[model samples]
Target: MALLHRAELRPSKLELLVPWLPGRPWFAGEAGAEVTRVAAYRFDDPAGEVGVETLLVRAGDGPVLQVPLTYRGAPLAGADEHLVGVIEHSVLGRRWAYDACGDPVYPPLLAAAVLADAGQAEEYFEVDGKREMRPASMTLTGSRTGRPVPTGPVSAGPVDSGGTVVRVGEVELAVVRQPVPADVPPAGGLTGTWPGQDEPVLLAYAR
Candidate 1:
């Protein structure tokens, strides 16, 4: 389970994202628009140090944007360009945030989820002196096609960070940057639905 602290973030996640969204290639929303969190889900890092989360947010009257981010205790080497920013966590001290795509630690986990029929990590919150289960902001599940899982580390291409298509080992996972079109092909990958969404859309899929 992932722990949730009641402590505050100096520059809130939204504060960091609002300005960064307008510059991303996959971002089509209006700049200077109010950014609101739609939903978020997380994956556990085997090392238990890095934090992996996929955030769904909307800017103005735009579509839900999917952003995968990783929070680290220190700077990620050779990932200067993908650095989102530095923020002070009231509980965890300073953190360096980066786009998960370039973090090296994210792809294999994503690949595992895509091929192993996995789900998001459970969340736990501590209050007073007690630990309690905290409901996820949204739900996510993974389904695998008939592909073999990788035994070792896997890599994704177009690693400049966000991409429309990411090649993960034998399966190429396509990112659904916006709402799914009516003609979207049925495929296996991580899928989720949020409030007001009529159908569950593929957030990422093996193509």
Candidate 2:
């Protein structure tokens, strides 16, 4: 896996995030807040150019949060089955694939993403617990066609305190952001509860 830490994410990653950050649920900017990278990193699929990135952003009043992102060269061909929506990259002038929140890659990458933000071995280890999290099994059929769910394609699943979503094929695995009670220890050892771990509700993927 191509794991890129904060320093490696610079220039290139920053350029990608400039326009992408504002659209996120965690984005505090009502008028598109200015984003500065506090820390960042990336991981690449061993087989292909599909890459995932973990970014820590200092947006505004919100806690410095880790935002995990994935980059693909092109959209998955048969993704209509799991279609969520599209995110337009201002710099690239192209649209990209988004996937289900339960894409299986999230918890591990989320742990790695936490390490990218904390910048310490012990702090990084704290996220190891998250690596063990898996998506809850569901019995629902595909909403669009009411067909049995099929296996999805290569996907990017990003999880943070605000929420977590995975976009693959045409399905978006959405885990709504929930408020973490004062009793629970925060994920990633950041200031507050991480986005995905709180109360999660799945939303059908859309643009």
Candidate 3:
């Protein structure tokens, strides 16, 4: 139940992206841009020590993108290449960080969130194309361990805006009434080969 503020979650590492945003195939920012964190918040993880944090970033000429991440203890042994930029904590007095996208714990947590947030009670759960969806009531309590176990299935969808084209998975399966964002084109959804993967899937249009 402990919530953290953007400033409280200091960056263990901060690297400037002079041209990173524009070149990203999924990024919507204008070419040759400079973006920064506009907001951030942490979520609980019931079974692990490190928690999940979502950083709301604002790229030049783009809408905010929610980069879901986790701060880890040891640098992920093989994920050195995916590091976004480490942050040195002024309060904890130690450098603590890691990317959950590269970590193993994110998929299930995401699946559970989609079900709980959407209020579906009969869906299943699985990871890495394992065909593992089960019926339960789960909630993503935090990025750290100790979350409640009421699990459900996750739906994927595209989240294009500004100049970026990122996918969001584990959305509630319930039929949505909301209009899809105008910036996100219809053809831009999750596309992968794995069955259990939470890749983005496009839904209703806003014509």
RMSD of each: 2.5, 12.6, 13.6
Give one digit per residue, the lDDT tens place, for model 2 in 30-136.
23455665544344443545555455565545445455555555665655533333545444434443332333444333332222232211112114344322221
Better of 1 and 2 by TM-score: 1
After the best TM-score superposition of candidate 1, give how far the Cα of residue 85 lies from its true spot, in angstroms.
Answer: 1.0
Residue 59 of candidate 1: its Cα lDDT?
Answer: 87
Cα miss at 189, model 3 (Å)? 13
TM-scores for all candidates? 0.88, 0.40, 0.49
Which pairs of residues clash in candidate 1, taking residues 3 or more apart in a chain or in different chains? Answer: none
Looking at model 1, report the run of 10 residues with the lowest lDDT sum: 153-162
Off by over 4 Å in 2: 1-12, 60-62, 77-161, 165-207
Q: Quote the RMSD, in angstroms, for model 1.
A: 2.5
**Candidate 1 vs candidate 3, lDDT winner:** 1
- Higher-scoring candidate on lDDT, 2 or 3: 2
lDDT on C-alpha atoms for all candidate structures? 0.76, 0.39, 0.39
TM-score of candidate 1 to 2 decimals: 0.88
Cα displacement (Å) at residue 68, model 2 = 1.2
Q: Over 4 Å off in model 3, which ranges?
A: 3-23, 36-41, 118-207
Per-residue lDDT tens digits for candidate 1, residues 1-207, read 788799899899888888888888778677978888888888888889999988888888888888888999999888898899898999999999987877777776776676676778888889998989987776666775666765454444552233455555566666666645233345667777667665776777667
Ranking by lDDT: 1, 2, 3
